[model samples]
Target: MVAFALAAVFFLALCLSAREDRRRFRNAVLFGLTFISLSVALLLQLDKVPNWVAYPIVLAVFAVPTLGTLALGVFLIGNGVTMVRKEGRRPANLLSMLAGLGIFGMIALLMVVQMAGSRVLDGIVGTLAVIVAYISFLFLCFLGYAFLYGRIRVRGDVDHVVMLGSGLIGGDRVPPLLASRLRKGQDIYEAQLARGGRPPVLLPSGGKGSDEKVAEARAMADWLIAQGVPAEHITLEDRSTTTEENMLFSREIMTADDPGYRCVVVTNNFHAFRAAMMARKAGVNGQVLGSPTAKYYWPSATIREFVAVFWEHRAVNLGICGLLIALGTAATLTT
Candidate 1:
């Protein structure tokens, strides 16, 4: 009953926090806690249930982690191979494959430690296991919350639809990835107009890269213009070199015109949540929307995004990991 009550509290907190500000990373933590507390409450009541129900639950509790990890490892490995073949040999493209291989490697290490029975090996494996578990939990929280955040609709009318830019192909042409963002932004703008709301400004935000012939925002603006967006409605912000910059510079332009402007920032689906976090940090009054991404590319890209988010919060993450390691080491030594 106490566990169930705890879960209820966590759920309520999660709902309130998410409602108050969907961009907060704390919302993800609350969401994860709600799920975990509920799971624990369920497991605690298993003993009072019928044997048939309890048996399957017991089997699942033990079997799911191993089986799920194996399945995930295989899927990521396959996706990684596809990414390498279809995308290229870039390090970014190899993330999924490397993560998959790391899973397998950990499993093998566990097996070897079981056979060796060395105290040192046990301590090392235990430390690694705890760290991995912490990271995996955080990743699950991020993945689940990101999915939920993506589904949320923009409330009321927005004054601008800011489409974030990706690198151009041929140093001038907008690639399919970036084109998707422009299309989504246009759709939002048209939808607002069709609904009898004011037509929002279309703001394409990015800068020229050393390898690019023209600024990314300029290329994106040209694409939008060709698609029939009015020159008067288009605002180009061609100074941002990163996602944080995209939000900050776009905020400056929007706020300059109307200090209390509301807007939506657009990026690829894999990047939407992190971009939202950046928007909040930049003091932008906006929600973020995601454009569709290629199916084959999403896993690696999503992993890359998670890595960035993890590093962004590295101080707390590393502290927790270090504590877990110390505890694991102490336990192993004492035994």
Candidate 2:
């Protein structure tokens, strides 16, 4: 009952945090955390037979991949039809269509693996479960870190600042995602200026996309200048097409005179951790700052970011999961 109660409490916490609107990943993980915590609690209360039974039940739960596969199928069919009708099957759209179909193929492969191997591979059934459990744990680690890291704020002196650009709507104007970043960056920039710091160079780093009328960096630079930030203080690095490019290009411009610079990367609050990871990869030694994000977009966006990070270092991630699974399988086998 105590474990159940704690699980319920965490589940509630997850729901509350999900209300941040745009952060779908955080909310989904919160709900997941609640469910797993409850499962862990229930495991503590069960005897051996029940514990054994729980494993199969969890195995059955893996069948949700079918539902995901179905969803993918339907979406791809609809998207393909629309794309074919509207664009006459463009190469890029066709690639997206193929990717969607490829997901269903993966689901099909897993289903076949389960069905054909169910008899003799029953031993490895537990093995698979252990592997999956650890993968879930890997997800949990990222979700936990992302949640906690989102709460941290950069509230002090800084010499250099980078407002990492999110894409804008209609190719020119600041969308809410990018706007939130700029506002946060501006606030930090103003705060520093007020505290007798002359003015930190605000690097708005993004190149213009083919679809966009102007570069995002220039838009951000203009916004800052109008907010009473002096023209000389805002250096626009207007040629980065991606986040890595944004960081690398901005750093190159900022560190043109001095390579060793202390700085903060400003982005949406939900993006702070991934941005920190990116900055670390780019060899930038600075903390990250997140501004307010809309509630709805964050969950899906943050989850996508988390998956990207995990896959970015898949060997390490897979190795850690492998270790955990090995341990769990041995423990289960022994018991």
Candidate 3:
């Protein structure tokens, strides 16, 4: 009952928060609460089941961590291969692979310590385990909520469909990643038109890079025009390099045309939540929409986005990490 109550409260809070502002940390908090509630409910139900059934359930619960770790490691390694083959061999592309290797290394080291019968090593491992658990819990919260947030549907009429930009290929050509955003924005426009509403303007948002011969926004606009979208309906926000600037500069154009403008910002699925948060911060009065990305490419890209989010809130993250370490150390000493 207590667990269910907590679940209800959290769900209500999630509804309120999502309605008020879907692009905040409260979404993560509500998700964590819901997970905890469901876990407690499952445990309670298991306690009433027959021993034969309950025992296997308990065993499965205990086995999940090991199975999940193994599966994640394998997936990351495979994703790394795909990234290299499809994208490039840059250091940024190696994150998923390196993370997979690190997980196995940590497990191996812990197993070695368990066999060596060294009290000091055990103590160190115990402390490290707690810190790792804390970080892992936070990462789970982020991953789960981001996935949910990206699935939200933007309804009603929109004034603009803003497509955030990525780097161009060959100094001016639209890359697959950026092309995906453009297509999504175009889809939103078509959807509105089909609903008998006004066809929204498409805003391709990005500035020129040092290596690029033209502004990314202009290139994106050209790509959209080539796709059969009318040239008159495209607005080029060609002065913003970063995501923050993408939202801000685009908002300027949106507001200039219609002060009460509503829009949907489009990006790849993995980047949707973070970009929505940036849009909220920049006071862009719109939701975010996501286009499909390659399955194998998602892990590394999601990790890169997660790292950016962590760094963006580093002070709070670092403080929580420091507290977790201190608590872990104290627990280790006591035991």
Q: In terms of TM-score, which candidate is strongest?
A: 1
Scored against the true structure, residue 58 in model 2 reaches a CA lDDT of: 56
Q: RMSD per prediction, one decimal?
A: 1.3, 9.0, 1.9
- Segments of candidate 2 deviating more than 4 angstroms: 1-125, 319-335
- Backbone clash total, candidate 2: 15
Q: Scored by CA lDDT, what does every candidate get?
A: 0.93, 0.71, 0.87
**Ten residues in sequence with the least summed lDDT for candidate 1:** 57-66
In model 1, residue pairs whose N, Cα or C atoms come closer than 3 Å (at least 3 residues apart or on different chains), thus clashing, are none
Cα displacement (Å) at residue 188, model 3: 1.1
Pick by lDDT: which candidate is best? 1
On a 0 to 1 TM-score scale, where does candidate 3 land against the true structure?
0.93
| lDDT of each residue in 81-142, candidate 1, tens digit only | 99999999999999999999999999999999989989988889979988998899899899
What TM-score does model 2 achieve against the real structure? 0.62
Candidate 3, 223: how far from true, in Å?
0.9
Error of 1 at 122 (Å): 0.5
Check candidate 3 and list the clashing pairs: none
Candidate 1 versus the native: TM-score?
Answer: 0.97
Higher-scoring candidate on lDDT, 1 or 2:
1
